[model samples]
Target: MQKPKYKRVVLKLSGEALAGDQGYGISHEIINSIAKQVVEVVKLGVEVAIVVGGGNIWRGVAGSARGMDRATADYMGMLATVINALALQDALEKLGIETRVMSAIEMKEIAEPYIRRRAIRHLEKGRVVIFAAGTGNPYFSTDTAAALRSAEIEAEVILMAKKVDGVYDSDPLKNPNAKKFTDLEYIEVLNKGLGVMDSTATSLCMDNKIPIIVFDLTKNGNILRAVMGEEIGTYVGR
Candidate 1:
């Protein structure tokens, strides 16, 4: 019954979040949970777009470290994102939410090629659009993809769904004394090397004046809370 603070938002989901506790591969339960949450927001009349990562299935950096060609490994990582996108589409459709999977790389059989106008049109029609394949280029991250998409779509904010509740001064799991920040400026995030996102992605958001909410996706109702403007996670912006 409550109104959402952001009518249009881009959700950046990490591959590890989809993997759930197993830390590898997709988890049906996790995917379903995310789908349900997204449905709830859609019902509230929010336009949603998602950019999913592929760290669970593959990591380009890791592969390159093991002697694989950087670009080849990155392409593999992009494929991994497509896999997660299809999985998410399946879950959302099963829940009666019309969803479209748009890929950066051409995969005509399975997904529509990424078109900026078509993506916006889907959102205007109340359909959720899931963006996969990491910008169709290597040496770029899904974070950057999210930033780029959010800017393109004119989204009000970015919901950065992560396993951790928020940005911390240190790794909270490793150091109990780590400080939790409720708010941060983009320059602070970058200058401190806080790692909320890659510098390029963070800079993109900063230049565009787009806000990002980094919250724990594993927490029940957190997605909804973030969209509704409830104080739940680290808010990063100008």
Candidate 2:
């Protein structure tokens, strides 16, 4: 077996990635596929932490644009992330992988409240820790949560699993001639206004000097590949 380049990593999964082709809700097949891939990485002895988004169920910004209270909408969006986290936890557990769903918001009934030490301990013990509900605050994207958690846990990198294969100059789906970048510097990502991640998330990672690998989650075994340093996606760092 090949050794993994990163001993510890934060895997960021957008809710839309969990939605799969349905484009609006969770898909069992897709979740199962993701769970299986995660198992592969776990078997490689890599410590895995995940930050899940809620765009599939709700988007705080979208709701606020339609006149909803911004904070209220964002809180609702946070709740949606918890839902996704539970679903993923269930999937991972079914595959015999020990998983914990940690929420930023206090929801003791279903998940443990976010405790940095506890989360890191879980990773050290070979358990998968899933971070949900963003940073438990409004106006912060889950991408920011991923960056924050990665820094806290001292993760080697952030694996941003997206629908697209990697970062591009334009939406590859819409622009046939869009240019795909093999690698990028943090300044370029911000200066060019690339959609790799939100500015806040990008800046946080840059400040922490954490590298990010943006790759397609739809592909089987891609997670393992990324962790194994396969160079299959856009590498963003200093």
Candidate 3:
């Protein structure tokens, strides 16, 4: 029984991660697997909050078409996050872990509206809260949402779970010679224009001095490892 490095952490998961290998839509197996890991961390006395992206269902910029308005497209992207949140909620509850889905956009029928104090209360009560809808506005990615929520929740760290194992000097898939960085300072990420996260998200984390651990969530039990500070990924922070 190892002690967790972070007592309260925010996990930023892309919607595609929920799809498993299918690359789209929620996979029950993947969802259940993720829920299990979350439960493991919670059992360790870590207060966890999640911010999920909607790339699996839609990307606002990509959705923009010759006829589609940018705002409408972004709204649709927000809706996609809501869908991911609901699916994650189902999976978590099925595992007998208490969870709450809080969206920036008010949709009382589906989830509680985002309120900083209320969300904090949920975390204090040991319930995992999933934040969806991308800041409740357009021209923002869920990455920014994750950063914002991490600051609001006063989380110890942001677990940035991606498809890639770690941050690379170049696209690892395309360049065999690309170097992988095990640790990076906040400025290095911003100075190099690293694609680890959007500039807005990166800037926010740097400003708040919040550490981010980027790793592949597809790896089983990675979440628990990260909370325990097992050195499994690229850590970017002060």
Give the alpha carbon lDDT tens digit for every residue of 1-238 in model 2. 6699999999999999999999988999999999999999999899999999999999999999999999999999999999999999999999999999999999899999999999999999999999999999999999999999999999999999999999999999999999999999999999999989999999999999999999999999999999999989899998
Q: What lDDT would candidate 2 get against the real structure?
A: 0.96
Candidate 1 global CA lDDT score: 0.96
- After superposition, candidate 3 runs with Cα above 4 Å error: 65-67
Q: Which ten residues in a row have the lowest lDDT in candidate 1?
A: 1-10
lDDT of each: 0.96, 0.96, 0.92
List the candidate 1 regions with Cα displacement exceeding 4 Å: none
Model 3, position 99, has a per-residue lDDT of: 94
TM-score of every model? 0.99, 0.99, 0.97
Candidate 3 lDDT by residue in tens digits, 1-238: 6799999999999988888889888888888888899999998889999999888888788878656789999999999999999998898898888999999999999999999999999999999999989899998889999999999989999999988899998998899999999999988998998888899999999999999999989899999999999998799989
The superposed Cα distance between candidate 1 and the true structure at residue 32, in angstroms, equals 0.4
Model 3: lDDT to the true structure: 0.92
**Model 2 ranges with Cα > 4 A deviation:** none
Candidate 1 lDDT, tens digit per residue, 1-238? 6788999999999999999999899999999999999999999999999999999999998999999999999999999999999999999999999999999999999999999999999999999999999899999999999999999989999999998999999999999999999999999999999999999999999999999999999998999999999999899997
